[model samples]
Target: MLSMKVLFAHLGREHLGVEYLSAALKRQGHETALALDPGLFGINDNVFHNARLERRFDQTRRVLRALEEQRPDLAAFTVYTSTFPWALRMAREFKRRSPRTPIVFGGLHPTFEPERTLRCRDADFIIRGEGEGALCDLAHALEHGTDPREIPNLGFRADDDSPALNPLRPLIGNLDDLPFPDKGLFERDINFRDDYIVLCSRGCPHRCSYCCENALHRLHGPGWYRRRSAESVLLELEEMKARYRFREVMFNDPILLTHRGWLEELLEGYRRRIRVPFRCFGQPALMTDAMALLLKHSGCQCVEFGMQTVNEDLKRETLGRPETNEQALNAFRICDRHGLPFDIDHMFGLPGECAADHARALDFYKPLRRLNRIKTHQLVYFPGTAITAEAAE
Candidate 1:
């Protein structure tokens, strides 16, 4: 086996995807390092407007210097649309400074916009979908001068040719097969105070028109929702407890209660093993008094409901989320009854959503807001989502 030093560049906040990939690579016996751009941590309400581009540029420069000093055989980058421009800049700088090092880009942006990602002057290759397997394969191929063109699920830029497209790899079937992400990768820098994350499953069951996960399913194929067993998830929790001493585990699952049986098993496992407080994202339809009580007993301290809008017409026709206002209110009431702190996520500026609709949503949540847990944000279109195409139209 060829040995190579790898640097994975993440210009974002604490992301489990990157952490998982980094850990997998290290377990494969390759030298790996991570460089985080500070700007990603500073993102807030005014992120798009007040983002200090120059400061991000400087931070990228510092990271590049560190990469050059380490002289890795390959450099990989993960980027979102917001950070794509800066990540591209860092990749270009790395290529210019170390012409021999190969640069690969991945993440949601690149996965959805492979052609655009490949158009980057400095990007040598782009990995679509998951990065753990693809990145490891690319690293091995690069280190040994193997033909990366043969690798599946990758797009590469070459001289005198358009981007070379490789066949798509099948999505991993047994999620339990993969090892837990290397937590040590970000142990030195990650602040778990306000941000703790866990992924109980991938993909979602609901086809909410505005959601990125729904778009992903449409683009990739249906039945993409795969979940790890309760035992598998509990093992991860045990690892987190042993390693990070985390106070809370936040389930990043797109929807945590899609399967009631799975939710029951997971809650039972948490109650048995973790015995620590946890939180999760929820869809209003799944909320019930019994379910809330079970979750609370199983250490759930908080829940976030995707109560996108209260306008009946807008909720059903525009967003394709058929949840009723009464259902949402009942869910919140369940949370209240169980003493579980709950936050309602409301999105404004959706297509055809007028000021009246926004105000109606506010009014619907106004009584619930007395608990001071309602959070609202202007809708932002993510690529490959139905709303993205709708916005374009």
Candidate 2:
């Protein structure tokens, strides 16, 4: 394939998605540059000529100027619902200045909701599902002048009415084949001096109605969950610990501690090789005494539970998460018994959630002392989740 330069624009939080794509592109001999938004980190004072917003505007101008100078063939964007407006705004501005450039949007927003995304004027193509390989395909196609219509996991604006969405690509079964994200690329805009983030796995296996993972997995076809080797994970941690000297590391995986054997091997490897106190995600049902002890021994300082609600009936009939309240409580108790700090998760503002449900949550929280933090996120209706249809009703 002909060599080409591609630039990635994103808002915040380590820039892992684009960094993986960057590594993939570089692995195939393409040039990649990251143009992260400084506005993402800026606070909003919520007033006219807000200094935070003004500073962000200035950063946007700098980005535009840099892109103009660099003149990359394609400007790929990692977008989310929160970052969509700004991503498109910058994309359109850059397109106005250099109309020949193609703008591709990826990530949770674009992946499941392609039609809504394509309606955005600047969204030229979307690489849905796991973008590492599909992004590489897009870059290669663009570099070699190949027809992009049939590229797997690609959605393109066509000449006719309906947008062209190619067949879904096969999911990456063994995630170890993918390159470790180039942390150096994101270190341009972030300093993880205290926090090291990792993704030892991809795709949560549960089909929680409100979660994007369900739709995302359907988009990937089947066998949605995949994990890297404990050795691979440990090696990456070893390097990051030595290089950044971070005080804490956090697993960004949706649900880690997938199984007893995998968790044991990882815990053993971590204890033997690395010890930078880390945190990870765990499901309430999967949380067990054995796993908690393994986590404690492995320097797992915290475990965040994704228990969307404490109401068992609502969870089963409405949320598609069937774990009992006792299951969740037992999970937390195991961690507490092991002296591992924990975070309890809950979702407020579901379709039928009421004052009683909230009071139930407060009552449930009263006895859970191991709780380092409690995260109560209001339900957001992303376009394609199973909860979306119910939410509309």
Best by lDDT: 2
Quality of model 2 by C-alpha lDDT: 0.81
Q: Which stretches of candidate 2 lie above 4 Å from their native place?
A: 38-58
- The TM-score that candidate 2 achieves is 0.92
Compute the lDDT of residue 194 as modeled in candidate 1.
Answer: 42
lDDT of each: 0.79, 0.81
Candidate 1 off by > 4 Å: 40-58, 192-195, 369-372
For all predicted structures, in order, the TM-scores are: 0.93, 0.92
Per-residue CA lDDT of model 1 for 2-121, tens digit only, reads 677888787656778887888778878888887866564345323453447544544666687777888888888887887888788888777788997888888888888888788766
lDDT of 2 by residue, 1-393 (tens): 478899887665576777778888888998888776656334322123356655656578777877898889889998877678888899999999999998899888887778888877687898777888788888888888887778888998888856778877777778788777888877766778778888888778788888888877766655887888888898888887788887888888888878678878888888888776888888888888888888887888888988777677888998898889888888988877878889888888877768888888888888877889887677778767888967677
Error of 1 at 171 (Å): 0.7
| 161 Cα displacement, candidate 1 (Å) | 2.4
Q: After superposition, how far is residue 156 of candidate 2 from its true place, in Å?
A: 1.6
Candidate 2 worst ten-residue window by lDDT: 40-49
